[model samples]
Target chain A: MPRGQPPLSLPALIYEPKVRGIIFQVLLLAALVVAAWSLASNVAVNLQRQNIASGFGFLDRTAGFEISQQLIDFKPTDNYGRAFVVGLLNTLLVAGLGIVFATILGFTVGVARLSSNWIVSRLALAFVEVVRNMPPLLTLFLVYFAAIKTLPGPRQSIELPLSSFLNVRGLYMPKPQWLDGSSTIVVAFIAGIIASMLLARWARQRQVATGQQVPIFWPSLGLVLGLPLLAFMIAGQPVAFEYPALKGFNFSGGMVVQPEFIALLFGLTVYTAAFIAEIVRAGISGVPKGQKEAAAALGLSAGQSMRLVVLPQAMRIVIPPLTNQFLNLTKNSSLAVAIGYPDLVSVFAGTVLNNTNQAIECILITMGVYLVLSIVTSIGMNMFNARMALVER
Target chain B: MDAGIRNRRIAITTAALLAVAAGPAMAQTKTLDTVKARGTLNCGVNTGLAGFSMPDDKGQWTGLDVDLCRAVAAAVFKDATKVKYVPLTAKERFTALQSGEVDMLSRNTTWTMSRDTSAGLSFVGVNYFDGQGFMVKKSLGLKSAKELDGATICVQTGTTTELNVTDFFRANKLNYKPVVFEKLDETVAAYNSGRCDAFTSDHSQLYSERLKSPKPDDNVVLPDVISKEPLGPAVRQGDSGWGNVVRWAHFAMVNAEELGVTSKTVDEMQASANPEIRRLLGKEGDFGKGMGLDNDWAYQIVKQVGNYGEAFDRNVGAGSRLNIARGQNALWTKGGLQYGMPIR
Candidate 1:
């Protein structure tokens, strides 16, 4: 390599591309640090000047407030930290159920939208257009008012099957009371699930090994269904149903599900399913036309061709967009504050933040929670996406 | 490479230190000066509560709480119409005041220990002496809150009413479930639709909410007062100058009522020979100078916004639809709790 005749001077070094890039990057980072520091200090000094309390110390203080829906055991005497956990669990419960229901409904509607039947496609198209056009909050308001308005009062509640009562207050059904031997039945149910999974893997391997296929559906179903029944019988029928009994003001001694929960869950699921349906339709259509033809030529029925050949490829496209819908539904669950569902944002952020008056701390913690939840969801979806991705070979 | 990294670290540390040192300096602006510069008082009121702080078709806010804001504005600007009413929810009131988004909060906020101390607010004085009560269907045949056992009660959250209901139920050894809401309208609607066995709130609010229902005559407010709710205006803490201005504005109104000075009679009362009336009407002393306001501050309030009795009558008393009787809210001489601090 050719060497320079003389060493570069200070001005030349500054003008050098490598040296200039490093200097500018350092300057940018320093500016960002200063900006962040000033913002934090401004909040701190403002809070201090106003004599408003700061910090997470208020988490241990007694909440002194009651929540309507609590997933875990909580009372007014419980501390703020427990209240937060209860609210988080409630949010997770709704979002988890919302995701499962929305996915199923979305996939069905998506397939219906592509169906040859004129009525089916038109109905699916109408549902997607109508629901997706309105705001989720408006939908929530509509659902909540409809539920409250149409249902009968407690005195004139509609009696459902299994001794359940449907009223404006809530839907009250019989709660299952676990006896001493209930744990044995639970263990048996879990074991049955594990056994069915193993049997399915064995059947798949047998099909791959030989041209002949062994029927695994009935055997797997029997194991999953029969084992739990046998355990229940052996345990002397350890669970009993506690029917709801009408008392002075309302029903007593039963599992009472609040209308707020129903409305919120229904609104979120219905609204999000509209978007998911579109995503699913796009995914199914993205598959090559040749794949279906190939499956059809192999003597596969239309359902078999779509399910076995088209859907597997469509999943890779569906998973990423589906992740976004899941995240949106989770965040939108905070609208529970409007309807009094006692989700995390409703109970913890709204009530706890007001009670403690630690706005910065409470808001930061709440934002952090959503951030972590979204990140975890993304990581899980990415892992599943990687598995469904095309093989390089 | 090490030298470059070391230089960058030094630069970042120095900048951070300087930035932090500037924070307290930036926080030292006086609220009074800011409000004066803005030429209008940013007063926080309820989003919409009948007879307390509701707006009409033209967006003119009118209520007992809205009058308090006008009184403060009249004292400061000598024009009662110079207030910018910021409607806030129960959950957003304190934060709005503490953040300086509103100069003062005239919302129907309860004067609690935590709010006055840690929430960075100072209560001027009680403008409304209310108590938590239950409103149920008239056909229920329930006489008292004690009969509300096994009842589902709907209540608004982020208020003293939430804690009060829990305490009341626990003290009475009764079983009840609370369905807490964020807004007053939602709570009222839920109760109206039979989603709750009873709706609990400040007695004044229950009356106000009852009027908004489909059939106001169908619901009856129970006589049981579960808790004391001294609703009043509040200003941010640490700004004694601004705090004194709002506090004296409220006091001037109460004092005017005690001295028999209504808005119609305020001009004649200014010419009275009574020394106490003269001092209150800005004829004898410069009382407003101590609070960084005009000498005619109290006069402006009395002349433009009327005295406390007039405001109460016009907003929530017999003159309005609510027609709430002055129970504990009457003047101290009439066996009530609203005694003004001596102007002297």
Candidate 2:
């Protein structure tokens, strides 16, 4: 239409960037749709032809089997769906505890690696190097075998204080049975926590208002412990100990911490902590040296400067990678199958799929669960990261 | 018009590529034909179940189940060595056969009704007559499974043993905990390390597993046969031709044992005038032809892998360290239940 411009045509339109981009995008979408449809149809036809039942309907059937470690109530007569829930809970238990333990150990060892004491730094270095290098599965096996091999039998269980027993089967401890009115103590503990939070906030505000510091640690501890103790006394000390004793073959009447669970937690925590330690070290190192120097110039001690200046800043960098380590620990808990821990993969994917012969359905469900777990973990860590992030005016 | 033509051409090419990416429409080929074309029989067996399907020190598999696979191979290829052994766990065995990863599964798998009907597996026939039992430490001095009231039992997961132990404990009103493991080695190791008070499995497996303990005599199998466990070979269902071939492979061995057609006497007995022996050795009728095999299928099976009696004795019976008696596994003529169908 313009003086020197050629008339718009189909050939010319194809060469245009906007038109080319749309065409390529549409073509790519079409290819993906076709591939996905073909794969699904292929699976369906194969499953039908093979006559192997493929659906989630089998979850309703009676499981007719037993699980060793259950965090919730379970029986052999439970349905497959309930068994799956039991497995999921066990997996969550191990992963949740593992994350907590690994974080504590990781932060400690990471800071120790930078300690001025040579022995402390070298020990931390050796721990991180050795554990991070070996395979998680091998470490699990070693820990499991060590527990199984070294521990004594129930008849000759090693005696521990407070009437606990350690044996090959497990660590049998005295379970605290709470009578009525235990709720009073629980309520007091919660109130103490709330009061301590309020006190710390007030103390922080007072310090900002007037350059004076309040001793929050001892007072907070006193409130927490004293409230709980007073509640227990007022409630007539409503707690009884159920000590485990050998009855027939194993210890009866008390809580038993299974070796399988202990080994799984130990293995996953140690292995995951090694990688987490490196992340922490990198995070701490990423903080500017100027921050520490400024704190010292203000007459703050090394410990105070580290606690007040460096770690807070380092946390922003540490959290994202630390989230990855947590997710990894969760996934690696699947290795519990090797040592007979009744985790999700061991129970649901391994046993249920085999019994039902519904591989596609069982595996799909297991993958979906892990996907959701990872997403939830990512969201939580991201929220925490947001809080620690530097705010701009 | 030229641009439109180019777009059409690109669409057609994309469709063609998509079709290629989606694997070829899997035509249901007869398993026999596929195995023949592949030139080796893919047989799934246990990872390591001694006296049943474990490999020897020389890496040569030698057991009752291994012999069954060899018998099928001998019948098809005329050479017992033309077999690819795929070691599978108890959990992996059925899926391996169902997926057609293996043409035949000769693992010591129990032939349950559910496996036969819904799981899409055709268990050919029982190769080992087994029953669930428990093995406990002799120091525990447990005489019978009844004494295992409050015990913790170690069992391999994905097995009928898990169910049987539960039922046994529940029926007897005994409280027990089950420590289940994925692999047989793990279960046995847990049992040996005193992690469990008892290890329960098929009776034959109990004897075999006891040998794995550091001191075999320190433990003993309790006098308990809780549930019927007829361990056998299985193949994918819906292939009647393939099913018949595997079925008769086992039947041929049993019939040979019944008719006294030992591997040593198979050749000489073929010349004997006994009609039963003649028909069995494939001299009278073309029984193998019905199953798409040579007429001398039974002869080859006998010559290569020996009869059922020899296999039992050599693997799990008195000749082996397991020393399991032929109790209910004996031929029907000898007051046992192993009755083979007539070849004719």
Candidate 3:
């Protein structure tokens, strides 16, 4: 419209920013395709020259090597596919246990850092600072070498509070042995959970409609826990505990946790908890102090004010960072290789690759598993964060 | 509008040109020639395994395996110092060789069939004969390996020792659990702390561990050989010329010892009346030249590091702290397993 402006041509219309963006993206995509094609051809040529065969058919072959520690039933004669499962389960076991313990320790230390007692707060702060600075591998070595190795032998095991035993070999504890009718108890427990959920929903609706709240917590707890016990009693209480008994040279008739698993779990939990504590501390501090004061102004007790008002808001900020720590813990489980825990990376990536001489395929599968796990975790955490986010009209 | 169209065309053409140029660059190959032209041999050694490959207090490597690495360097450049020792562990060693990070691996590596064929590596020859054995504390009163039926064994994670221990226990119908560690030091430490009932590894390694332990005489290696471990040197499979250079380097040492050409008498042997001794000392013929090495390549190796027997006796045999008798590692003339091929 201006006088100095020249008329735009048809080609200029096609080359506008919006149009150019599409063209640029297409070009980038084409370049990527070409690069990939060339890389594939180069690999083909190299493989031919080196006489190296590349395929996933090796997964069907027998993995002749025996795993030192396996959760699932496995033998050297088992297929490579079975070995993969063994590795996956081992990884999940470590990550799952590490997550549970790290969260507990993290929350306690985080709150203690804000404690009224001077010594407690200082000690929590010192732990966080010291652990966060050291490498996870070093921490693992310290625990495995200095801490666990110092334990007494089987003959001189340290008796814990319970009938549990701790020795240099491993932790020996009483394991639950399920007899007949245990399935009935399990079924009843599931039914109890469903009943509790339905009851809670009904109580919420009733409270909203009549402005008269029902004491749902106690009733729900009773239904969920009491029903299971009632079912067990009616079914003749079929489950029993097998306490570990010391034999001549070793413990027998109970579950034994290997030192490798303990060291890995201990290392991961301590390392990840330091980061989680920082996240928790930051989350609590981020909540405006006015929220707590507001709850107090409403005549709420200190405990109720913090729990009902502060924690809800703090958790909203904490869940996202806490999720990140979870992902980190999962990845760090690969370090179990250092202690020879037979996790996915050590068993599948390291041992399997060595035996099969299929480094590319093995490493790809290992990385792919990790990538899928991370993606799933992130998606799950994002869904949780969305649910906790504040709604504004 | 025309200029805009022209610019777009130019951009597309440039990308296409780059894509075309990348094909040739990616397909290029000449790794073998590059190694030869470099003159200096890249040799992989074990990091700090005593009697195999360990750095001295003065930062120089000294051991039988380290000597093998130097021998290869001497064959290549007529100077034993022209070697760069890339210390590698068991897990990293094969990958390093296959990836061309090291020209040859002279570490105390077991020469297995799978590694020879599947790993794209060629074992030239066996340098030492080793076997897996158990080492336990003297106070345990475990005189024989068979005495401990349910003993927890501390073993290094990735080695033949792991498989051997399992087979031994399985065959004996004994129930034993292994407490595996990635590093030798950690495994030994675990064993010393009584975390494990016994430590299973190569007999040579057990000997080394005993020396490094807090109380050297407090532990003893059991008199049981669990597995056959033919430790040797290896090179990449594709290059026959490079493989010969490495293989002959080892053989030269063995031949020198068999001919009684010690480091002290190598110079005198060069002028000997015996034809075979003269030829071996690089005085009569160009035998070394045929193998792409200097005539005096073997002379340099012996002069710098001594023969194979000397290196063995000094590091791991009767003369060392290990006090291991050369039962199978002795020469053929001495009625032992080490019967090397003739140089000619």
**What lDDT tens digits, residue by residue, belong to model 3 across residues A1-393?**
779655778688667889778888999999999888886776555544554546789889987566767888887678888989999999999999999999999988887887789999999999999999988877887887776668888989899866889998788888888898899889989999999999989988998999787888899899889999999999998988899888746787678888889999999999999888888888889999899889989998988886788878989999988998999999989878767678998788766766777666776788899999899989998998998888777
Question: When only chain A is evaluated, what TM-score does every model earn?
Answer: 0.96, 0.95, 0.90
- Angstrom error at residue B117, model 3: 1.0
The reply for model 3, stretches above 4 Å from the true place, is: A1-14, A210-221, B1-36
Q: Candidate 2's residue-wise lDDT over B85-161, tens digit each?
A: 98877777776676566889998899998888778788889988899999999998888899998899998987888
Query: What's model 1's overall lDDT?
Result: 0.87
Record all residue pairs in model 2 with backbone atoms less than 3 Å apart, i.e. clashing. none
DockQ of each: 0.36, 0.35, 0.23
lDDT of 2 by residue, A32-57 (tens): 99889988887666666666677788
Worst 10 residues of 2 chain A by lDDT: A43-52
lDDT of 1 by residue, B44-90 (tens): 99989999899977889999999999998899899999999988778
Clashing pairs in 3: none
| TM-score: model 1, chain A | 0.96
- Sort by DockQ, best first: what order? 1, 2, 3
Which candidate model has the greater DockQ, 1 or 2? 1
lDDT of 1 at A28: 100
Task: After superposing candidate 2 on the true structure, give the runs of residues whose Cα lies further than 4 Å from its correct spot.
Answer: A1-16, B1-27
